[model samples]
Structures are given as structure tokens and as C-alpha cells.
Target: MPVNTDPKLIAGNSNIPLADAIAKRMSMHRGQAVKPIDTRVERFNDGEIFVEVFENVRGEDMFIIQSTSNPANDNLMELLIMTDALRRSSAQRITAVIPYFGYARQDRRTKARTPISAKLVANLIAEAGVERVLTMDLHAAQIQGFFDLPVDNLYASPIFALDILHHFQDMEDVMVVSPDVGGVARARELAQRIKAPLSIVDKRREKAGEVAEMTVIGNVTGKRCIIVDDICDTAGTLCKAAEVLMDAGATEVHSYITHGVLSGPAVDRITNSVMKSLVITDSIEPTAAVQQCKNIRIVPTAPMFAQAILNIAGGMSVSSLFDNETLEPIYESLYPNS
Candidate 1:
């Protein structure tokens, strides 16, 4: 039998809305409605995961859209099991599209006897028979080397730059800031795109999830500062960074984070902090508190994901999607109303 080349999308319970949005955007690309495979990822009473794929995916190009976000273990297991099911079912190729890769921060062992969980997770994915992996804005770029298979790491800078351009009319006074020194490259890329200056927050971390002290490295006086980073967990770092910027005489502070892992007190901090707005992507499903937050906004990544999926399926260059000229058309196609 000839191998089925049509792309088939399957999603776990992590972010169904994002999966559906991607399907819709892909449908627009194909000029026909492309729906996700009828798969059910349910749990047993004892907290075991059970995944059932109703559609025939045999010999098809299968893409599983699942983010290893909150409840990271369960979501990761779901993706692995789903990949196993597809491989066993004789799918031609299986790609795991994880928007938010969990345990990415543990890419290295900072101390003795600590495990590099990111590499371990990469090994698990490879062992599960996944042929390819597509993820976005990894906490550390080095994590890509851990994967044995082809891993397409997409960037959110294109999306974020577009949003920043539309939101802020005066680009001269806008400054792109890296919440920490490590993120300076990410922030610099966005700064170049918008023709803005870049600044780094000099910070020292005593331990995980805690900051010892922070100081501004550049003049933020009378400037509209936008902090760019990959993750925002407890909001401690971001909130403190905002405060430091404010203390440095910043006219206003804002943030464009890729993953909004707003855990305990994150929403509260952002709500009461000096930041003007917080923009994040729909990599993880937002909780009710996040949705109700006044200053937080979510931008859809479905269009970019849809374009990437199309390129992969068509054997096109994925990197071409990053060019401003290339991204403008994609942004227009998916978000015509905007």
C-alpha cells in the first residue's frame, strides 16, 4: 500500500484549545477542514492514564500536539504513550509537538548528585519511538543536542516583536530587557527586530526559585522597558525585576514571556506589581485566575505552528518562517481580523 502523506493531528488533554486552533489554521491552509484525530486521553480512578485513538492513523504522517506543562509528569506520560500507540499502529512518521517542554531548566547539573532531567526526558522521548520533536522557546538552547532525532526548536520572537510593534507606537523610547543575564541573547534578538536598545538585569540566584539580589545594568530612566524571557514560574524574578526597573526610573515596565507557568502567587504579584502588561503565549492552558487577571494577555501560537506543520509536511524550509517578510504573510493569513 502507498504511504499516506496527509498530515494527521492528535492532541492530549494538555491544551485542547491550542490543538483545535492549530487544526483550524491548518484547515485554512489546505482549503479544507482538518480535524484532530478522535483520540481520548482519560485517567483511571487510581490516577493512571489511558489513551485511545479511534481513527486509523496507519502509514499517515502523525503529529501529536501536547505541551508538557503543569502536571508535567502526567502530560509527559500522555505524550509518550500516545507516541507508542502510534508507532505500534504502524504510523509512517510520528512527531511530538511540545509547546512547553517541562524540566528544561534542569538541563545541567549545577551541583553534585543532581540529574539532568531535560536530557533524561529527551532520552525517554527517543525511546518511545518518536521520530521527530518540535518545541518552542526552550529554556536552554543546548537541550536540542540531547535529542537523538531531529528537533525543530521554534522561536516566539517573531510573534512577540509583531505584538510589541502593534502595541507600542513609539519605538524610540521602548527598550528590550532581559530579566536575567542569560536571556540577553533572546532579548537582543527582539530588540534588533524592533530597533530598540537592550538592557540586562544583573541578578544573583542563591537557589532555585529564589533571587538573592538584582541590579539594573543599564539606564532605564524614562524608558518603557519590556522584559523578555522563556519562562515565568513563581513571578518572583519578574516582579522583582519590574520593581528594580521602576526604581531605576523606568517610565513603565512590561513583559513578553513565552511560557506562563504562573504558579502560586504569580497572578497576585503581577496584579499588584508595577508592570503595565504581561503578554504570554498559549503554550499552556491558562487557569481561571490567569484569565481573570486584568493586565495579562494571551497571544495564539496556532498560526505559526500551523505554518511550521505545513512546511514540514511539504518538505519546505522551516527557518524561512522567521523572516519578517515571511512572518508578516503568516500573521496576516491566520489573524486577518487583527
Candidate 2:
């Protein structure tokens, strides 16, 4: 069979909305409607997953859109299984478009008898016959090295920076903050982009998911603090950091987190926290609890992903998407009035 030059998108059940949004944005980019490949992902009585690709994928460029999010194990398995099926169907090329790559935090072994699960997951994807990977805002950038295939790690900083620029007219009083010392670089990038001062939250963690004490490393007094981080799991760190910033005389507190893994009482914690609002990317689908939370807002990442897909398919540079000139149109499309 002859190879189909057009890109074919297939999605697991992890984030159907985001996949559909990407397809819509891709359609706009191509000047023609591009729909996702018809596929069925179902479950057996014992919770085993079964995937079927209804369309002819032979010799076509295939991109599977799936986020290893809540129920991470299941979603990850679905991606691997789907990749196996695509490989068996003789797809010309297979790219895994993962908005949120789970098990990323386990990139290294901090303790004895620990496994570097991120590398293991990378191996799983490659062994399943994926040719490339496209993901966003990985917890650790070095995780890219774990994969032998080319991995394009996209950033949400540009999107957050533009959103901040549009919303906060008064840049003088705005301060970008890192929730912890490790995130200082991420926060500094955004601060530099928006031309705002940078600050860090010095916190000591006694154990996982718990912060003992948090100190504001810089003067947040009389400033509207914007905390930046990669993930918000239990919300303990973010909530505590916000409290510390407020105590340090911050006028208002907001957060721009790349991934909203809001698990285990996170929604309740954020709803009652002193933070003004929390802006997260739609990398992972928002839950009903997250949707009902008034202060939580989601920024669609579909436009960026769509552009990246188009570039990849055309043999164009994916890094060019980061430029303001290129991003302006995407940002504007998301917030047309701005």
C-alpha cells in the first residue's frame, strides 16, 4: 500500500476533549477539516483495556494523543497498546503526543531500592514502536534524554507570559515567584518574559506532599505575586506558599501551573486557600470538581499542539513555535479580544 502523506490523529480516552480541540485547530491550520481517526477504546469486565482502529492506518503518519493523567497506569497502558496496534497496521511513522507525561517526577532515584520510572516509561513507548514523542512542560527536562527517539518538549511559559501581559496591565507591581528553589529557573524565564521581578519560596519538605516551613526569599510586599510551578498534586505546597507570600505582604496571589494533577483534596484546598486564582493548561482534562471551582481557569493548549503537529508533519522547526512572532497569532486566537 502507498503511504498516506496526510497526518492521522488517534486518541485514547484519557483526554478526548483536548484531542478534539487539537484536531479542530489543525483543521484551521490546514485550511481543510482534519478529523481524528475513528478508534474505539473500551474496557473489559476485569478492567482490561481493548483498542481498535477502525480506519485504514497503513502507511499513514499516525499521532496518538493521550495524557498519562489520573489513573495514570491505565492511560499509559492504553497508549502503549494503541502504539502496538498502529505498528502492526504498518503506519509509516508514529508519534506519541502526550500533553501530560506521568511518572515524570520519578526521573531519578532519590532513595535506595527506587526505580527511575520515567526512563522505564520512555523505554516502554520506544519498545512499543513509537518513532517520536511530543510533550509539554516535563517535570524534569532531562527526562528527554531517556528516550532514544526525538522528543519535542514544549513550554507553557509563553502562553502564561502572554496571558499575564494581557491581564495585568500594571507590571510594576507584579512579581513572578517559584514555589520552591527548584522551580526558580522556570519562574525566572516567565519573569524575564514579562519583565517582572523574580522571587522564590524557600520551603523545607519533611516528607512527600508535606511542607514543614516556607519562607519568602525576596520581598513580595506590596506586590501581586504569581507563583509558577510544573505540577499541583495535593495543593499543599501551592497553598502553603501562597499563605507565606500573603503573610509577607503580597497584595494578591495567583498561580500559573503547567500541569494540574489536582489529586486528593486538592480542589477543596484551593477553594479555601487565600490565593486569588489558579490558571492551569488543559494538558490534563479538568475534573468536575475543578470545573466548578470559580477561581480555577483553564488555558487551552490545543492551538500550540496543533501548530507543532503541522510543523512536524511539514519537516519544519518545532522550536520556532516558541517565538513571540509565531505565538502571537496562537495567543490571539485563544484570546481574540486581547
Candidate 3:
């Protein structure tokens, strides 16, 4: 059953800008100077975390928005402590709204003996008293099975579809491409939505830290390609794929990735890659380097999330927001200001 009460939005340091954007959409965010809830999450000199909720949350439905992105351990602990605090304070319900779920790529164990870190993260969140979780585009769809609580796995395909249509109205020579064989389904859906052909990059991963060699699976010659993937960790796969496609006579190569974990030499690699642009969502906040790169663009995700939260509070079906093959009408309904 959906809770009809207005939910309280609490934020952590993981992605302050994203959190503020979500709150602002709900008309709950006051400028930095004044806020309804005073969240005090601090760390000791030795790197220990402590959290305290100053405002009274007794019997309130609290929604904590925190992305378990880079610095995963620290941000995760902060969420745990804050959940504990809210539970101890007798909050009616606690929902952990994690945008970019870290450790999600470690969902399975391929080696003889290894830890399934994604399952462990699910355990930690459940153990912390989180009643529900709302996350976007998990690396592996099976990660949802690890969670005991109700999980709403939102798709970023709708977001990407709208942006692609707005920029590339003439789709005659456009092709949607998967960076690697693993992401064919994701890329296929976007291609189908935009009425474009689909292509795959067959990659050979020799070893860690080595750029993969790829071969195009479909005809991309003379076509403007849109490479799609769930994540862009170091940008090696995308950069290499872009070069391969362009070398094969591709006119332009653009990318749409959900979680931009632009770590290490990602920004530098993307800057030098043959890709025309790299569009990412605000699931994970962009770094200064990512911001400065002319090829990197961030699509605001607050309005999308804000509408999802509103639907949840009103007992409306949230999936209805983007449950169709065509997504232009959905985006317009949710973000008319755009």
C-alpha cells in the first residue's frame, strides 16, 4: 500500500546538488540558508562517521536521498547511521533513495572464492531498517533479486530517448550501438524507441588496464551512431568503440551512459576520443574535470525523480511515467518547463 502522507526529504553529502534539485522540485527545499530538516552528518579526525537528525521526525515518512557513488564506504555508512537514527526516532517509514548504487557491478562471483559485494550492500541496507529502495538503472538487472525490501528499478532509457530525439530528429542515418556485446539489449531498446537500426561492438578483453579491441557487429558506415551503456567507469570501452566505429566510416559517435563513474583517466580519455559528445544523467554528480570537458554533458535527473516521488506519495503508478515504447509525451508531461 502506498503511503499518502507527504514525505520528508533528507539528504547526505554524496550528491548535494542532485538532492537539492529533487527537493526544489517538491517545493520543500529552501535555499541553503534555511531548511526544514537540519541534517548533521559529520566525521571525526580519525575518519569515523556520526549522524544526528535535528528536526523532529516522529511518525513522519522520511525519504533519504543519497547516491552510493565514489567514496562508497563513507557515503554508505552515513546512510546506514541516518537510517538507524530515523528508526530510533520512531519515523513511520524510511525509504532509501539511492540514485547510483555502488558495488552493483560486483553482483556475481566468477572466481573460485569471492564476495558478492552487491548482495552484501543489499543486506546492509535492509539491516539498516530501510523499508523501500528507489534506484536507477542497476548495472546488472539481477541485483534486484538480492534485496529483501521492495525495490523500484527505474530505467534511464526514457531519459536518453528524449534527448536523442530532440537532437537527432532525422534518424535515417542514425544507429544505436552497444559498446560491448553485454549491453546489446539496452542499446536495442533505445534503437527500437527511436526507430533506428541497432549495432553491437564485439570486444576482446585481454586483461585489466588494457584498452579492449572491438569489431562492429552491424553496418555503421556513413551512419551517425549513438553508443549506449549502463556505466562509464574509466571510459576505455566507449573511447575505443568510438574510434573503431569512426574508423569504419561512422560520421559521428555520441554516447549515453547512466552512471558516469568517471574515475582515473576517464575525462582525459573522453576528451581525446573520437566521440562527438558524452551525455550522462545526474545519477552520479559530475566532477570538475567532467564539467570542464566540452564533450561531456549532464542531463538533469531531478525532475524525473521528483515526479516519481510524487507518484509514490499519491499512490499513482510510477512506472506509468515511462512504461511505453514512445517517451516524448511522457517527458513533456513530467517536465513541461523543458
Candidate 4:
């Protein structure tokens, strides 16, 4: 089914600021114009969830804005209930705009008889009556195949590339480094954008939560290295990669990730690492620790997401979202040389 524009934009408590920013980018006025529906998520005495859609949405196309980032379970439950509420209220169609899809890393069964949680989440969304899905920078691209419904997996590459070009004064000397072989495609895509050389970190995982840094695959010595990854969960991979790069004679190390799931000592690791800076998108809410981390910086993905929603609404090609010139003009118009 084709996505609809002008759908009633409903927001849960997950990431209201990002939703609001998307609203502004679409030129929708505050309050009634976009018909923002608020999902009142509450908890019962028995530890159950209760959700109420405060507005009527009968026969209207709906898009629920929520991110299953940190506190993934609570946010995921909120999205499920919102979808159910909209479906029950007789909405025409529903799309879950999940900017940071949690549990995406569990795309495969790594151990014996282990369940694929990513596939399970996909099933849950489909069962909730979501007609489609919109997400960005999933941990694994194959996860998209897990969804029965049509899924539009957006990219933060355009946004991240633009930021790198702007901030890194010596772009010509920058080398894009992938933290692992699994992310070679992602790294190459961005490296091509910035016209930088590409390298990979030949890392070995000794055990869960422990990484053994082996070697650098390409020549990164005496060049500024930028490690790229889809998500930064524990910062273990990135920090280890940075250390290896520095040891191999990299002049400086910087990093960019699409989603920053800074769990358990991630902030401390990055804060004390040899990295010059860590740039992440606002796909997930940053904790106070993330904010306090001196090396961390946030780049907004609101404009890109807003343009995508507007393009879908206007019967335009959302693939155009990846066109740098198409979106760059508007982004500059809004961000002003940013």
C-alpha cells in the first residue's frame, strides 16, 4: 500500500521533541493543523499498561511517532497500544515512524535455540495493525526482510555526511573507518560521499562484552580517522577501534554513529577515550550522562524525517530523500550554513 500524506500525526512520550521538530519542518502549524494526537500511557497497579488516545481519529490516515530507544520495553508497549487504539478507532491506515528501532541488533540467532527478537518485534508491529513502517539505520539491513508489511528503512547517511563535511576542516585528509567488517557497506557509502579513503577494523570478539583489537585493514596511519557505525551501544567497539587507530599512528580519531544507545559505561568509555569527538543523530533521546560527556555532540535528523513524511503525503518519491542536492537546499535554508 502506498503511504498517505497529511495523516494525523500522533505522538507518544518516547521522543516528543523530535516529533515536534518534524512537524515544524513540514510547515504544519502548532495544535490543530496536523491534528497531533497524544497517547496517554499509564501504568496499572498490577504493572500492566493502559493507553488512551485523547482525540478521535475515525477514518483518518494516521502515523504514530515513537522511538524504541532507551527504556525500550516501555516505549515499545506505548507504540503497540497507540497502533491498537488507532486501529480500533477506525483509522484508514497506520504507519509507525520508529526513528530508532530498538532490538534491531538481535536480527539473527547467535546461539543454540535462541529466538530472533528482531523478528518477534516485527511480528508484534504487524499484528498491531500497522499498515507500514518507517525506520532509520537499522543495525542490520536484513532485519527489513523480517517485516511482513512494507518497511521504508531511511538512512542517516545524508545527514551524517553533511555534518562531517562541515565540521571536519581537513576533509581531504580524513579516512572513513568501519569498526567491523559487517559495516563495510555503511562505511563505504559515507566515505564515497565525503570523498575520503576507506579502512576497516579487523577486530575479534574474545567473548561477550569483550573485544580483542587485532589490526587495521587499510592504511590509516598519519591520517585523521573517523569510525562509522550504525549504533553505539556500549562504545566498546568504537573506543577499541579508536585505540587501535591511534596506536597505528593515526593523527587523530573521530567517530559518527546513526543511533547512540549509550548503555552502561558507554559515556564514560567515550569520555576517556582518545577520540577527538563523537557525533550522533537525535534519533534517540540523550541521557544526562551523554549530555555531560565532553566529547559527544548531537546532529538533528528532524529535517530529513520531516521531509520524508511530507514527501509521502504529497505523493512524491521518498527515494528522493537520499538526493543530497534535493534535501541539502532545504536543510541549509532551515539550518543556515550548518
Candidate 5:
């Protein structure tokens, strides 16, 4: 289904590079009029966020492309203020296109007295007048249930599978590994696509930033292992998992992750770890430390993201793009003979 409404795309301070890429994709498909909206966001002297949408979006379908990544609180507030501004301007419908949903790790309270901050963020966005949300690879799938509005949860599996296929041919010995038992379902999906065996890392998390002991649950000895997960923050678990995988006789250890929230000591840990390399999507803009890391490589997600925005604008199925069997045909349509 082709789209009817012209998109008035807007971007916040969170991920400008990704926003620009999505806007450019829309422009190429729609025309010059579908350009990115001019907007300014800044902080006042009192440390308050100020947002101004310079264009007239009254009755226009507005999509704000922002990721709630690092500086989680600031970025989250910026998206909220931007949504409020568009609502006040009479935009037809507001869609929060968040690539990395921060605070999503707190979806459920493991303890009795802690707050479910993920649900709180959902409520805050709904109260901010956001009518719809489009995000990719949420920390937990149930976060969609928290929203009162339409939420589209996209995945990176298609891209990751395509990447794996392009790099490897005889995948007989390749293994898709889950860093923890909690991620086994995700690992199973990837393992099925590549027709590779699966492995699980059973580890006990004694605290937030510490991993007590990790044990490999499958036969990874002398085989290449690809550890998969949603987010790699601080690199504690990833680093430790790599160490154990190597100690268990795995020839090489690599990781494929959606969001790289490489906070304090993450880069340092990755650089000194036994992992061969880490491949992360460009959901969160690459930082200077990430760019300088010798063991880290980034796979561009702009093309897929651009196609997704175009699909949503056209009222088409965005989830189909994430299908294991549907990605390559679409990729060939976008960039043939590549």
C-alpha cells in the first residue's frame, strides 16, 4: 500500500546522523518537498530543554526520529518536549520513532519495592501526546503492551542474517550463542536462519555490573562462536563471556548486538578482552571511543531504516522487512547487484 500523507520528518539531539539518513531516504522516494523539518533544541540557562519546530506542520503527518540512548534522561526529555511542540502545532498524528529505548531494562521489578521505570517512560510518552511509536529491537517485547497507542517493534535479525550469510558459506561449524539463558529465544531465531547450532552462556549475575561465573552450555570447542544479545552496556557480561568461551576451547569469539551503550570502561574492556571482534548496528550513533576501538566494527542500518520509514508512510507492513526470508529481496530492490 502506498502512503497518502506527506511526512514532515523532524529530528532531535539524540541521533542526528540516523535522522538525516532516514530523511534522505524519504526524500529520494517521495520528492524534494519531503525534506527533514528544520528544528532547534537547546537548554536554557536554568538547565531546561527548549524545542522549536520552525516549519508549519499543522495537519501534517509528523515523525520524530530520535533514540533514547546515552544521556538517557536528557534524550528522553527532548523527545517528549518535541512531541508536545508538534501536538501544540496541530500536527495530524505524532509518531515517536525511537531506535534505542532507554530505561527499557527496568521493564519489571525483580525486587519488591523497586519501580517499573519502563512502564513509566511509556506512560510519559503517551501523556506527551504521542499517538504512535515505532521502535526497533526493544529490550523486552512486552514493552509494547505498556503503550496505549500503536507500537511497531522492528528487528535487526534480517540484516544480521544477511551479514552472516555474506561473510560465511559453509556454516557447518558456526554457532549462534546467547550471552545468557534469557536471550535463548533470540538466539534460536538467528540459529535457525543460518542453519547453525546454538549455544547458551549460563551465568549468575550477582549484581548489576558484575558477573560471578559463566559456563558455556554447548559444544563450542574448536568452533567459531557468535554471541548475540540486545544491548551491550559497560561490556562486563560480553567481556566475561568471551573470556569463558575462549577458555572453553572456542577458536574465536564475536558478538552481534543491536545497541552499543558502551558506557564507562566498555571500550577499555573490549580492547583488552579475548573476543576477536564486536559488530554493532548504527542504532546509537558511534562515539569517538567507539570509532577508535580497533576491535569494534559498525554495520550501517540507514538503508533498512529508511525503507522502514517509507513503508510506515505508505501504510505498508514494516515488520515484514525484519522477516528472515523477506530481507534480501527488499535489499536487492534497493541496491541491486551489490
Candidate 6:
């Protein structure tokens, strides 16, 4: 079937700048048929949320852009209520475009009685009247299986890979490092794109909040190591990995993560760590903590996501966007000096 034209965009309060940029990329001016469903998201004295979509959406094809980031529950419920509102208003379809999917790390239960919160979130979205989902760089890939509806799990590696090649083009010795065994596949995929070697950090979890980096699995002694991962929450794993790599004789330690959900003292940890730079995408809105950190840098993912939204609306293959040979050139143009 052909992709439908005249797709309607509906945005939540999570990241309006990103939503606006995506709308712009789709060749739509800021205020057109596509505009934010004007409403106020508030809470009562008892701490419950209230949302109301002001505009009419009857028989429209709606795409809701929201990031389940900080105050994840609120942003999540906002999406749910927005979907239900659209459904009740007779919107033909509702697509939830969540750039930074929160609760994704809890895709599986490691303990005896723990809950798989990611699956539960998926159920919540489905039950909330979402017809499909569009997200990027989930913490766990298997979470896609949790969604019964059509799920488009996009990648940020192409964006990161191009950035690295442009910034470190002259540097001959380069290696992509995975902070833990779990991230080896993602790191390896990026490494293959840049023709760089791959290294793994062997980490031992002493407790819930602490990590001890043991050894480097691959040769990274003389190379500039770039640690790659999906998210940097507390920066515990990244800081530990950078220290371990530096101690292992690596020349430099850099990091590129998709979602910079830098909570708590993550920015402080990165600022005080051995890493020379920590590059991340704007999948999650940058908080004041990120703005205050000198070591943190943001790579705009607006174009990639914008193109994805356009393709999806036009009934084109969204996956083919990453397969382009011009990816490096396009991304490098965005960050010339890197």
C-alpha cells in the first residue's frame, strides 16, 4: 500500500522544538494544517494530571510526538490521554512518535519477582488507543517484541558514525568501545561503518549503583577509543569504561550515546571523568544539567527523524533512509568541525 499524504501532526509538551523541526522538515511551515493541539497539562493539589486537547481532530490521521523522558509518568500519561482524545474525536489513526522511550531499560526482569516494566508500558500504550509506535535506539532491542502493534525502531548509529568520521578523519588509529558486553553488537555495527576496530569493556557490577571496570577485550592501547551506547543515565558505566580504557593505555576516550538521559550527577561524573568529550543526540531534551556541562555536546537528530516521518507519511521505506551513501556527507555538513 502507498503511504498516505496529508498526515496530521499532533505534539505533546515533552519536546516541542523537536516536533516543530520535524514538521519543518516535512516541508510544512510552522502553522498550517499541522499544529500542536493547544491545551494545558496541569496537576491538582493531590498530584494527578489533567489534559485537554483544544482543537478538533475528527477523521484525521494523527501522529503524536512525545518523549517519555523526565517525569516519565506524566509525559507518558499525556501521550495516552492525547491518543484517547484523538480516538474519541474520531481520528482515523494514531501514531505515537516517542524519540526517547523511557522505561526501556527495564525490558527484562533479572530478579525473581521483578516486573518487566517495558512490556507493561507497551501494554499501556496499546490500551491507550495507539495504532502504531515510532521510536529510536531503545535501551534493549527486544522491547520491540513487547509491542503488538507496528513498531518502527530507528537507529542513531548512522548519525553517530558520520559525526565520528568527520571529526576524527585525520586520526588513523581509532576504535569503538562498548561500555559493557550488552552493547557489543551496537558498537560493532558502528565500528564496521567506520572501518575501525572494536573493543569491549569487561565490567563487574559490585552493587546496583556501582561498577568496577575489569579489562579491555580488544586492543585499544594506542587508539583513540570512542565508547558508544544507547543511553547515558547516571554515567557510571561510561565514566568507569573511560577510566579503564585510559588506564589500559588508550590515547583518548570519547563517547557517543543516542539518548542522553543524564539524570542525578551524570553531568558531574562526565565532567570529572577521563573522557575528552561526550556526544549525544537531541532525542531527549537537554536539561540544565547538560547545558552546564562543558564536556557534553549535542548532535541534532531532527533531520533524520524528520526524514523518517516524511517517508512514513509518504509510504516510503523508512529503513532505507539509513542505507544512503550520502549519509556521511549530509551529517558531516551538519557538524563541519565536529
TM-score of 3: 0.93
Candidates 2 and 3 compared by lDDT, better number: 2
Clashing pairs in 3: none
Off by over 4 Å in 3: 28-36, 209-212, 324-338
- Candidate 3, run of 10 with poorest lDDT: 28-37
lDDT of 1 by residue, 80-168 (tens): 99999999998999989999999999999999999999999999999999988989999999999999899999999999988888878
| Model 6 TM-score, all chains together | 0.93
- Residues 205-286, model 6: lDDT tens digits: 8777688547889888888999999988899888988988998999999999999989998998999999999999888889
**What's the true lDDT of residue 146 in model 6?**
97
* Per-residue lDDT of model 4, residues 180-214, tens digit only: 89999999999999899999998889876789656
Note the Cα lDDT for every prediction shown.
0.92, 0.93, 0.85, 0.85, 0.86, 0.84
lDDT of 3: 0.85
Error of model 3, residue 60, in angstroms:
1.1
- Say which candidate scores most in TM-score: 2
TM-score, each model? Answer: 0.97, 0.98, 0.93, 0.94, 0.95, 0.93
Count of backbone clashes, every candidate in sequence: 0, 0, 0, 1, 1, 1
lDDT assessment of candidate 1: 0.92
Work out candidate 5's RMSD over C-alphas.
Answer: 2.1
Per-residue accuracy of model 2 over 1-338 as CA lDDT, tens digit each: 34344788999999999999999999987789998999999999999999999999878899999999989999999999999999999899999999999999999999999999999999999999999999999999999999998999999999998898888877899999999888888999999999999999999989888889888898999999999999999998999899999999999999999999999899999999999999999999999999999999999999999999988887889999888888988878565644
Number of clashing residue pairs, candidate 2: 0
Candidate 6 local Cα displacement, residue 283, angstroms: 1.2
Global local distance difference test of model 2: 0.93
Off by over 4 Å in 2: 1-5, 336-338
TM-score of 2: 0.98
Shift of residue 335 alpha carbon in model 6, Å: 4.6
Better of 2 and 4 by lDDT: 2
Candidate with more favorable, higher TM-score: 2 or 3: 2
